[model samples]
Target chain A: EDQVTQSPEALRLQEGESSSLNCSYTVSGLRGLFWYRQDPGKGPEFLFTLYSAGEEKEKERLKATLTKKESFLHITAPKPEDSATYLCAAAGASNDYKLSFGAGTTVTVRA
Target chain B: GAGVSQSPSNKVTEKGKDVELRCDPISGHTALYWYRQSLGQGLEFLIYFQGNSAPDKSGLPSDRFSAERTGGSVSTLTIQRTQQEDSAVYLCAGRGGQGRSGANVLTFGAGSRLTVL
Candidate 1:
């Protein structure tokens, strides 16, 4: 069975602190890995998609890197406004397009 | 361009009542998806519609959940005999069907929050 697991269920960081969240997966074939940020009362917002090992993408203080069995979302100098639940999902080779998502890591930045 | 849109941002209904949630995908996006998110939980895939072909309903939790896409544009998800456990945020997303960029990034809507009393 394909599964995704994220580490550090919750993290409290002071403003300007940098950290990384981990997402590990077990699947037959990895088609894509996705990262999303979700705020309260809203749907998730797309962040990045990594297709192959060693692939990396970035957007405004957030960087996503992928490997053969896992992915990492690194936040640089995170601010209070950047606090949100970060989710990681993986799609398999079957083209089912059904993303198996991790439970997500909740980050709270204290000012 | 307008992103995916869902109707009735919030809904509250009594148990055993039926409810219908609507999704309007971005114009020209042929791939639409539905998911459910319980409080503080990750997304649970509900269904996927690719063009006019039959949808993939494998992820639906029960037979009481059904969805249909009309004209390859708007889609509706209907839950029959709602239960208290059915309460969740229903999210809709859309992507270009084929020949798009790698992996076809999904655009999501604000979602509809359902509460069963």
Candidate 2:
């Protein structure tokens, strides 16, 4: 079974502080790795998709990178609005569009 | 719509009752997915639809759960004799018709919060 595990279940940071969340996974043949941001009572919003090691994508203050065994989401100079649950999911080559997600890291940025 | 849309944003029901949740994918998206979120947990895949054809449904929890899509468009998930364990947020997502490297990309709705009494 494909599995994903995220570390630092929760994190608190002051405004403009920077931190990185981890997403480790084990899959037969990773087809894609995805990052999503979800707010309380709202569904997840797509962020980035990493398909290979050494690949990276960034949006505003968020940057996502992938390696063979894990992926990292780095937030730089975060603001209170950036506070949300960050989810990591992996889709294996064996399954088409089926995603296995990690428990997620809840990030809270204080202003 | 601009994004995936789900109906009945909130539903409170008694155990043993049946409920139906609906999803309207983005206009041109050919793939749709249903997921369950319990409290603060991660998303649990419930099912997926590829152009109105559900090639996989093993993620569904039990026989009491069934879903269908028509005309290659909207879809619905029906739960029979609901239980308290069924209380959670039901989220629906959709992806573009073509794009394997990015096939896993999903756009989600706000989700429907279900509460079983």
Best by the lDDT measure: 2
The CAPRI class of candidate 1 is medium
Q: Over 4 Å off in model 1, which ranges? A: B97-102
Per-residue error at A98 for model 2, in Å? Answer: 1.1
Task: Give each model's clash number.
Answer: 0, 0
What are the per-model DockQ values?
0.59, 0.73
Candidate 1 local lDDT, B4-87, one digit each (tens): 889989999999999999999999998889989997677888888888564587889999998999999999999999999999
| TM-score of chain B alone in model 1 | 0.93
**Quick one: best DockQ, which candidate?**
2
Give lDDT tens digits, candidate 1, residues A3-100: 99999889999999999999999966787899999998888898998888999999999999999998999999999999999999888776536787
DockQ of 2: 0.73
| Superposed Cα deviation of residue B88, candidate 2 (Å) | 0.9
